[model samples]
Target: MEIFAIQGYVDLVVFVVLLAVKLFAFINSLLWSAESYEAAGKLTKPAWTIILGIGVLLQFIGILFILSIAFTIAAFVYLADVRPALAGLRRR
Candidate 1:
């Protein structure tokens, strides 16, 4: 059906967007130091870095249904929640 075709395109767009988010989060995580993460109220920088790194690799492999959702939540939480807190501290 025409609707199904449209939905497929929509899904692909969403996936690509999410993948970009994950990659950005992963790169930032790698760039940030452990003390920065801790000051941002994050205890484990390596854990998040690894999580996002694997998430990106998996997305590239195109095996991202459950793994994508789980890691995407983690990545966004770090980006939206933790990164804001870190930025606030840096502005001081």
Candidate 2:
């Protein structure tokens, strides 16, 4: 019983962290200009916005775990790859 309780807490932490990352990615996507995405050779701003938005929404609802994981991967891609490309353009 104690182990189950600990596992529940761990699961809750994971869920919260996933939601935070998705929310951050969605918000950051909104901050960049459409032109910045084009200049960086990434997807259009609207596309990213929609993708991240859906991810955040799905994560928040917490019903479909598989879909949530898929969207989480999308968030990671935006943060790890597309974000740096856009940030690079901003620095130059």
For this target, which candidate reaches the highest lDDT against the unseen true structure?
2
When superposed on Cα atoms, how far off is each prediction in RMSD? 1.6, 0.6
On TM-score, the leading prediction is 2
Q: Which ten residues in a row have the lowest lDDT in candidate 2?
A: 60-69
What TM-score does prediction 1 earn?
0.85
lDDT of 2: 0.95
Error of 1 at 69 (Å): 0.7
The digit string of per-residue lDDT tens for model 1 on 10-83 reads: 98998889889999989888877788888877757888888889888887777857987888888888898877
Question: Per-residue lDDT of 4-91 in model 2, one digit per residue for the tens?
Answer: 9999999999989999999999999999999999999999999999999999999988878888889999999999999999999978
Model 2 scores a TM of 0.97
Whole-model lDDT, candidate 1? Answer: 0.84
